[model samples]
Target: MRIALCALLLTGLLVFPGVLPNSPGHLGSLAETALPWFGLGVPLLLVWAAVRRSVKEVTCVLVPAVAWVALFWPGIVDFGGRDLGRADFRVLTVNVGGDRTAPRDVARRVRATDADVVALEKVPGPAMHAYEKELGGRYPHHAVGDTLGLWSRYPLRGVEKLDLGGAWPHAVRAVARTPVGDTAVYAVRLPSVRVGLGKGFTVQERDASAARLARRVADDGTPRVVLLGDLNGSLRDRGLAPLARELRSAHRQAGEGLGFTWPAAFPLVRLDHVLVRGLDATGSTVLPDLGSDHRPVVTGLRAAR
Candidate 1:
């Protein structure tokens, strides 16, 4: 029992972040979420062993539990969402649940935030027309790929359709010329989560999209890049490892707590995100709901200038 407890703590330490395979960041992430519980549990185990008068067993459990808490507790702090400076440019990314009824609400709410650029997902078929009518004049530069779209208040270049195959927005790439500078924004929506012994997502589309986005960010030579949308996987999940490597999560820079953004009625985990690399993340945060199951993540950034 003592040896097993030590091994559990050791394994979780080694499996974090870049240490493990890229395909399963979530379960690896579970180490972060579940370890505290283990910390709480190990102490209980120590008491039991102590009651048995096995000081050796109690020592084994107590040491690791105390060490584990001390080592990984910093990760528990909310590193996402920071404060924006005067030079920082801002962007808002949200999944509005494809409901046309909220088009006006979406536009009004987003515009009110005074965000310089906006990237929206789950743009409904019915809402597309209304969205265009409401935002077209205001946001002259934009990119739309079926369900996904990017609307900017600035002049945009290299607008193209992002094909996220199989009814899910696996990927798309665009260049946004913000007042701060030009940034390549890759809007992606990965396969939904399904935990099982079997492989959950085929990952063909997800991987392909990730590869393409990574390639673009790598070769584009821009000092800044933003990948935003309903990635379907948390920043810690292995599914987003490829993407995670190339970009830093916006929320991690400024958000508080888990900042969960899914199942809007009662969000338990953050599924929507905005990741950036080569750009200095000034701040990141979640926006209130406007009829979408996924809450929006807003980020403010500044490039090396």
Candidate 2:
């Protein structure tokens, strides 16, 4: 009976996480954000069944194990195929946090990626000058709006601030003229979410901001678009479903492993993403830490002609 109950609990969390209540605490959203980690319970259950010497319990354990594999196996495997030729462009995005020291070092590390485009968020106003100075030589074209910034090796045009229902601008949009063609790029930093003993999961502001951002992206006329930012929530979180439906996550398409990028010292969840549309993602990876709370994500893309 203990094994049966354990199996049911694991399966329910894996397959029906959405059914969990969101009020008081946003349990459902939290489950979805940490969904992949829940697979760890499968082995524990299997061990318990083995000790009990019950074949029935062992079979029950297989139920959740299968469900976990079916849901996340694709993300774990690298099925991006062999040698998709050279990537037309590479993009990198990172939330540099509010660190006052070593901003230059951070800029140097990011520059070493050799990405055609770079997006940075949570950059304090004063540190902007430092980044501009360090990145200016490599990326001649750039734009900065509030804490969000975009730097490109290609010429950038139509630079503008995006209002995602925030008091200050936290998003920016620009067009980059690359050899392949023009592509619209967005640099965004959605509102942060908090979970406290008293408040539970506080994501109301982030959810509203995500909705506004989704609407703006939908209205955009550009056929090719690349969104780079710290979304503050993973793709599995319902708050991001609107944008998730509109864009394809580069990591999911080409990356191996879970690609967690937050709390850089001991990464636990993926808060940064490189999402695209009208482009083929050839490769995606999380870069080494650069003195920030969040790590950087890089993706290789080719125009989907």
Candidate that would win on TM-score: 2
- The candidate maximizing lDDT is 2
The deviation in Å at residue 139 for candidate 1 is 2.5
- lDDT by residue for model 1 (1-305), tens: 75446646554553443364435433554443233334555666667786878767776665666666564454456443347654368888878887633788888888877777787877877777787777887788777777777888877787666553466545567788776677888776666555456553344455555666666566767667888888765665554566778888766665545567877777866778888877766766677666788888777788753
Quantify all predictions' global Cα lDDT against the true fold: 0.67, 0.88
> What is the C-alpha lDDT profile of model 2 across 210-281, one tens digit per residue?
888888888888888999999998899987888998888988877757899988988899999988989888
Off by over 4 Å in 2: 79-85
Q: How many backbone clashes does candidate 1 have?
A: 21
- Candidate 1 local accuracy as lDDT? 0.67
